[model samples]
Target: MHMSPVRDDFRRSQLAIAALFFLLGFQYATWVSRIPALKARLDLGEAQIGLLLMTCGVGAAVSFPLVAVLMRRFGSRLLSVISALALGVVLVALSVVPDYPLTLLVLFCDGVAVGCLNVAMNAQGAALEARYARTTMSRLHATFSAGSLLAALLASGVTAFTGTLAVHFGLAAALLAVLVVVARPGLLTDDAPAAAQDGPDQEQDGPDQEQDGPDQEQAPAAKKDRRRFALPAAATLWMGLAMVFGTVTEGAMNDWSALYLKDVVNAGAGLAPLGIAVVSVMMVLARIFADGWRTRFGDGRIVRTGSLLAGAGLALALLVGGVVPTLIGFACVGLGVAAVTPCVYVAAARQGSDALSLVAAMGTTGLLAGPAVIGFIADATSLVWGMAAVAVSAAVVSLCATRIGWPAPEPHPEPHPEPHPEPLDGRLAPDAG
Candidate 1:
């Protein structure tokens, strides 16, 4: 009936990481749900709004090198807390920005904070999995969806009473501050080094080990060499590609599904929002259960099967050309791809911090760019073709999932009594479901 200190620590770390995930989603949705208010306040047209959104993505994409360096120097725990606090402050700034140019600058900074927190939080999640020899990433992602949904509902409720950005965002930021403080103490420290050393890339012969030099000389060289950015390994590249395509599928749906419903399916104004609602609901539900699926089928099977389901289902919906089938298709896309990014993050983190940072940045780019790309395709051709492109993105994810080297699940280790237990120091372990 009693839990060991190590087990309790694991539980606390899991909660802490989950809270960080929730904060990320909540903070993002809080701003996103208020875009209309922001647009009205700035007197911005659609094109200008697009530009503002794109700036955030640009910032996230360009943050890869910096995130990698900070993760190595500060570790994920400190970096996660710091980036999260910065995100909270930026949220407040977003509510009060005086001009469009200044707003763009703040959003760019917001994106950087988002990128940093994204990588850092996932690193913490990966470390938890490695240490406990369990699956938690999927459920942690579900908390993110839950947070977003909560923010959306809160925004709606607050809008009914008032359209004030300060009231809604101020409340959201305050909640984020509270969550950050609560999560800070429970986060694990000293795990980043273990994760990096246990990564798949560590299989290569290091200069310190392979070169015929003194330990004193080679150690400094090796340390310095690690600080420089190297090209991602083949496996890392494949994982990053999967991440890109997976996010493209997700982001395109959020931006396009409602428009697709209205224009293609000829749905009423009131019913069109259901397109987003269906996908969001199904995705949250699927993520809630996805960790179990990962445990039973392995990460490779989950990614491949889910990606195929999303691509094929959407393609069928587009071919059928009806509202009912289209909504069903959106639901399929949501349910199928819900676990893709989380699974990819686990795989990338196992490749090391550089791989993790690169893959996360790639995902940020896909999320921001995919919808715009789809818009161009729709303009050049038709909305059907645009939707078809999304299906292609999902298919690409499936294909890349096949090429990446997935780690075999580790067997559960026997229980130990050490106050500080060592991590499995390799990869995530599959558990009996």
Candidate 2:
């Protein structure tokens, strides 16, 4: 099929947005891969470490509500640039922090930046997808996983060579900053074009107008437009909850998988990260084809299946309790969650950027909260049981899968009809029917 100029513009925008996703993942994994080293340096216990990790989420949660206001005022494109810069700076600070409290402070700040970056970038991605008039969320998320996988591999190699987080993270921070600067030109400013916005609403609104007159059709549209940037409705809330469940599973694996393997499975430094790599690769692989699966099976089925797989996979790994079995289990977990977030994000984007930010924030809380939950559990019982939280999260997502419902389609403005001339008598209207 021949591509139009508009599609090509969106395609470029998509690439730019995908680059941002990749960088975000890369930054996150770089820090996560170095957690073992940081843990040893601080000599913190499981509970302390968990609480420390929770600070990131706390910061993010605090910032979530503000994202909508920020986006509304400054626009997502600008926020993406500023938040990414903040993220890079915080990451560099994390690498060199001397004390635990300072590290906590830095991580809290990192979480704030991350909160902005997460909502902004995803909102931008959703906007681009809306402009393109198709499903691009999975592919964008796949790029993120790909970045995380690459970063994990690089961190492993860098740790082997430099044996320091400062050098590894410093270089990564510099690279991301430069790349984002270069890609800033391609980021999108608008959620959707006027033409694209009106088209779908027009088609969907046709039947409603036929049932009710144009005046009735327009009242709801005007009301909806007035509230467009306000609070999300019930459906958006449900979507956000679904995001929380999926993110809990994903966040747990990202933050704790390597540490878990090293402490629990007795895997060596080199091998421990490999467990996370298995999950990362599986998630990347699953997402690579998620758009296609979505095309064939639809969002509901993909989410339901992915949720089941994630839960079952984690349970299997936790039950088997070894390096190899755990790896296999995490791999299953990865595949299961690959499609869930992307689908949810896409659904929210279809609504509008406001809805996207609200849902994204809700979902992000789940991701950031997972590590803290696991840490507390591990401190109380064991890391194995703590890790079991991922399985539980997966189960929650499976149950909530049906709640990831589509957004209410926006109403289109009815085209004004041309005026008809009256008859010569000026009393009887033309076309008296």
Candidate 3:
């Protein structure tokens, strides 16, 4: 079991992770973007919808780490399949369930499934370079954002043509059918009960690592425990910060964009999709090339720079409030956040491929934590202030990234030999870079 050949296998594994993100995207896009439509069907007010949205964070918080531990213990392949199927079923429930409380309950379940799926996907993505010696997490997350953009388009399309919940729900189900097929081959990785047997030490390392030494040209068991999570730690903080800023802007667009446009900008319901979908477009484009920036600059510096831009964008939106400034603000924020999650998780993988699960879990917590805190603020104070809170959070994220990844991890051996030489250009970990 020399790990030198695993590089190709790990790269191949990335496609599976991408498809998983795509599937997850199909659901999440609807959650944020479909509010106006959902409000019509459910006939709910702002506060109630806010409460329902909050439930999602609660459900996600509970489910993520549990799934991370399970995926680490059991295996990504199995847990992911189960989680995906459950997510689809719950999505259908979200579309049809008219009862407000029932909808919240179902959304909770959806969050649980999505949270679990996220942990499983990142654990797998991190393993690509973590076990193989190359980059994978950033590209995989780029795919994740791409999937979200795709869903944004799909959502707009569905809204335009039919404007029916049944049609949208059916589309989700159809997408899941394709996802199940694509995900099946990967699911087998988790079917065994082997997870229970793995001790905490083994579980701490996300997946199997059959490699050796601190440098290339392989052998065995100089297995570096490499617990200095500083790089990923910093990356994780920035990621969380990005989520806070991005989600607020995102939440605004999701929950209020249409309303704002309809009321403030005096636009019709149909055209209001521009507010959210436009940002999605920016994010999709940015993720494709963001790594190049990170490679030249560093994740820490880039993220901080992005945060400042995102915060400035928020200010622009707040101050200007007109269509052009608002759009620019949204675009800036989208571009700022586009590459962040990928950068962070990839940093985690680089630290120790074995620790991918733990690091991914920790990283996802930042996502979960930011929303919960913001949701409470939105619930208590005004929504505008809540958004301002997101800006502050991003600034805080910038500070945290600086602290988390300094004195980067010691260099480790290449886990495998590759057809291509490893790219010498790389960035600081996501948080600190």
Candidates in order, TM-scores: namely 0.91, 0.72, 0.66
| Residue 405 CA displacement from its true place in model 3, Å | 2.0
Model 2 TM-score (2 dp):
0.72
Task: Give per-residue CA lDDT, model 1, range 1-433, as digits (tens).
Answer: 9988877877899999999999999998899899999999999999999888888889889999999889877889999999999988988998899999999999999989999999999999987877776688999998998889789999999999999999888888899999999999999897676555545434343454466554555465446437534756777788889999999999999999999999989999998999899988898889889877777777888999999999999999999988899999999999889999999998888767788899999999888888989999999999999999999999999999988777554445323445343335533322221
In the range 179-285, model 3's lDDT, one tens digit per residue, is: 87775664324212222222223333333343432234112212232232222344444444444444444444444555445566566677677777766777777
Candidate ranking under lDDT, highest first, comes to 1, 2, 3
lDDT of 2 at 259: 92
Tell me how candidate 3 scores on lDDT: 0.59
| Number of the top lDDT candidate | 1
Q: Candidate 2 clashing pairs?
A: none
Error of 2 at 263 (Å): 10
- Candidate 2 local lDDT, 114-176, one digit each (tens): 878887788777665444434577889888877887899998889888877789988889989
